[model samples]
Target: MFGDLMGMMGKLKETQAKVEETKKRLDTVLIDEKSNDGLLKITLTANREIKSIEVDDSLLEDKEQLEDYLILTLNKAIEKATNVHESEIAAVAKDGMPNIPGMDMFK
Candidate 1:
């Protein structure tokens, strides 16, 4: 009936708003990563925006070592951020999803 359709539409709108809010919240969620020896450190938001980088004095002496440290540390930080981002968005989307009859099969 048209009533059910209208209710579903309203629910969808509410869900969308929640999802957007969750995304904004994720901007403050930070993920930190460091090199094995503590020579390099990285911090990024769940949205994958770099927040800071800390490098030890020893790392500056060797360009290649610094590059390697950057590559590894940045990669690890990005991976963690990606995981956080995906899980958060998925949670929001799944929670917001309307329970249509056939949709249960996808779960």
Candidate 2:
């Protein structure tokens, strides 16, 4: 039992390291989102750090419209990023998990 426990602990540590590495890698993963009319384009890392924002001259003329576009586009990008981040981490964790009974986390 103790041996099994030790093994599980070691596996947990390894999985944690892998998750960390994946998160760092995600920092380089770029997600691009654009407004429905293509007047606003934004790029950001999978870590949700904004990298660039491109706006059309027409959008620049209206502050409220620009804010709305930014909010909508950023939310879409953030949702995509969150999905990727969660899936990657879950995959790494599920792969490294010690097969303990009743712990089908991925299911």
lDDT of 2 by residue, 1-107 (tens): 99999999999999889999999999999999999999999999888889999999999899999999999999999998888888888889889888989999775
Candidate 1 scores a C-alpha RMSD against the true structure in Å of 1.7
Looking at model 1, residue 5 earns an lDDT score of 86
Clashing pairs in 1: none
Model 1 TM-score is 0.89
Provide the lowest-lDDT 10-residue window in model 1: 98-107
How big is the positional error of residue 105 in model 1, measured in Å on the Cα after superposition? 7.9
TM-score of each: 0.89, 0.95
Best-matching candidate per TM-score: 2
Off by over 4 Å in 1: 104-106
Model 2 residue-pair collision total = 0
Question: What tens digits encode model 1's per-residue C-alpha lDDT throughout 1-107?
Answer: 89988888888898899889988999999999999999899999999999999999999999999999999999999999999998888887777777888776425
The whole-model lDDT of each prediction reads 0.90, 0.91
